[model samples]
Target: MNLSANNLCLSVDGVDHLENVTATFQPGRLHTVIGRTMAGKTTLLRVLAGLEKADSGSLTREGTDFLNIPVWRRNTAMVYQQFINYPHLNVFHNVAFPLKRAGLPRQEIQRRVRRSLASVGLADFEKRKPSQLSGGQQQRVAIARALARGTGILLLDEPLANLDYKLREQLRDEFKTLFSDQGDTIVIYTTTEPAEAMMLGDVVLVMHEGRILQTGTPQEVYERPATITVASIINDPPMNIFAGRIVGGQVTVAGFQATHVSAHLSDLPDGAYQFGLRATDVSLASTGVEGEVTFVEISGSETFVHVAVGESPFVVQVEGIHDVALGDLVKLRLRPDRLFAFDEKGTLMQTPSYGLASVEGR
Candidate 1:
């Protein structure tokens, strides 16, 4: 299932919700759609699943334009954040509903329902109603229903959002394995969590303000985000952005010495550029950029030190939880290759210099 969205745009009641979004989802891989609330991530998934029509643009699967395909004929299964199971129906019946709608023989529906429920680790829970199951279990039942429908494409609209941390993690890993084992299934899922994108996505599409900011592998997006918005959305602390300028291949911060990354700087003009560096990319040293620590957040394994470097606040991820107090004097250094530069328009200037060419580009 090679899926493509060409100039996809959508609006509701004359209000623009999604704009000019384009992406290709290859077969047998998980594509995660991530963005802040109202960023059109859900709307994009709806369009792809044929639940909502694009106001403009087209959707295609393997070169066949599917813009006019009816929802039921699209062979797309959509699972929303809310699991829509019938309260009175047992788990078995809920999972069997899709196959039932297919007008399958009773025996066939029973077999498919059992198989689907078993696939989602709910084999023994067939008789339990939605009210009898945990939130995570209900979600699994919902997924099993999609599988029972035999959809070629799966659309998950924040399906894991309602679960607890442990359940969410468990389900996420399960979905990852499900995609790996289910050949030719194309999954497009939406999430607001960057960590989830990093963990589960083969390719993560970052959306903002109704437009796609970037689409690439998790590593590519994390290390070579195509725009400031892309950079900001893919990291835990997000990337630290600073206003600066390039002069003779050297980038000078407002109150720090000049330096440059290994990224190709030839295509850029010789002055005035914005710089982006991730929290993990900044190192601590007394001789580097000076700052006054304003706050610190420790997460057992790492500590995020929020510092006021000149007039701007920047966060640095250090090795372990530190005892550095607020107002402590500190020095920060940018990792050479991790520093990303952008022009005034917020486009990422550095492409990934370390990886093989993208599968899409190939």
Candidate 2:
């Protein structure tokens, strides 16, 4: 089933919790809704599932007006953060409950139940009660239940949030493969984690303050963020931002350009502009300007170091936890090509960035 929203909005107590939101989810692909807390992620999911009515907007599924459809007849199922199961019911009964509600025949329900359990690797635990299973297993049962009910659209609101990191990662891959194999069954999942969004989503949507900021493939969103917020959300350490200006043919970054963009240098008239540089774009060199190290965090794979360079503090990811300590003076320099310039309003500036060759031997 294909689902689309137009001018969708949901307000509560005079506040627009979800406003003017619109997007389309094609069948057989996973779409991720990402936003920070209070951004109306869950509210939007409820509206799509027909659990909550939008204040103003239209929803269509397969060319039919979905808002006109009742929740029971929508063929949409919601899996919540909490696995809601009848405590006394066994795994088989819990999964079979939705089929019974749909009035499916006993034989069909039994077949669907068994198949669903096998899909989530829970076939052997059909007779076990909910309390006897772990949290991960309980969530798998929840997913199996949705599948058994013949749900056309699956709405997951942070389904794996409460699981351990290892299990969460494992389930993420499993869920992606499951939906990939489903072939035309729509799955709308929401999460605030950037890594999860990048991993599972065929289309990633960045939302904030009740609106969709940007939607594109993971690489599209990361390589070319539509807004400053989108860039900030996609990167783990986030893009570094500093205030500077273009004055007298020089792009001053914290009062020092060292590197200049002369081709379209006159584009931005002398004024304050925010300089955005990712940690990967900046590096430490032997003969660069000396900056004091503020902090260092080693995470097995790489070492993240914060250094103060003039008025701007930059983060650099070194190979490993070296012998560097806080307050140590280190020579630091930005990789010219990786630097991104933004205007005062957080919009990216239109200009060619300097390349690594421009800074390496300069």
Candidate 3:
């Protein structure tokens, strides 16, 4: 089922929650909405699920008006950040509740309950109450419940946010695989984490302050963020931005000149601009731009070195272990092709292109 929202506007008690928000969710695809706290992620999801009404605009499913439909009749299932399960009900009944509500046969309900439970790794705990399960387990039960509902639309509002890091990672993969083959369901997932959005979303919508700033495939948005705000929210460690200027066909910043300029930047008229670089695009080398390593973080599989160059601080993500220590002087090297140039107004200036060469070192 195709879901579309047109010019959705909502406000409560004089505070605007959704402002002209519009988007279409295609059937069988997982759409992700990402934003910070109170950015209207929840409000938009509620509007889509029919839990909250939009003061203006319309929602439709294949030309059928959805706003006029009651919440229970919308045929949508939602899972929130907080675990929602009946403490009085055992795992089996909790997963079976939705099926039973639909008045399915006893054997079919049991079969689906077991299948959904196993999908979320809760098959062996059917007899246990939610109170007896760990927080992650309980959340899985909630997910299982949603899955068993067999709805055409699934709305998830940061459903995995409350789980531990390890479990979140595991469930992320599971959810991706589990939903990939569901060609008839339209899943809308909201997350504060960009990595989660990138991993799960076939289409990502970046939201801020009740507005969607950009919409595209994960790779398109990540590689070519439309504005600084989108870039800031779409990166895990965050993009490093520096004030600089274009001079003599080169970009200059922090007393270092970048010779490998993208051809799309030729029309910028040499002046003030902002430069963006991702941590993964930088590396510590024997000789390059110099910086002082102020902090070091070792995460078993990788290391993140926080370095200070002049008055600006930059982070470099390195694979595995490194010999660098705090307070060590290090040389930083950047891949020019990986750099992004934005105008002083925070709008991305460089057009999408490939195979750009770095001019000989300056």
Error of 3 at 350 (Å): 1.3
**Winner by lDDT between candidate 3 and candidate 1:** 3
Could you tell me which 10 consecutive residues in candidate 2 have the lowest summed lDDT?
Answer: 352-361
Candidate 3 matches the true fold with a TM-score of 0.90
User: In model 1, where do residues sit more than 4 Å from their true spots?
Assistant: 62-65, 248-250, 258-269, 351-362
lDDT scores in order: 0.82, 0.82, 0.88
Distance from true position, residue 28, model 3, in Å?
0.3
Q: lDDT tens string, model 2, 14-118?
A: 989888999998898889988887878899999989899987889997789999899888988889988788889999999999788778899999999999999
- TM-score winner among the candidates? 3
* Candidate 1 lDDT, 22-44, residue by residue in tens: 88988889899999888998888
Against the hidden reference, what TM-scores do the models get? 0.88, 0.89, 0.90
Residue pairs with colliding backbones in model 3 are 260-358
- TM-score preference between candidates 1 and 2, better one: 2
Q: The CA-based lDDT of model 1 is what?
A: 0.82
lDDT of 3 at 17: 94
Worst 10 residues of 1 by lDDT: 353-362
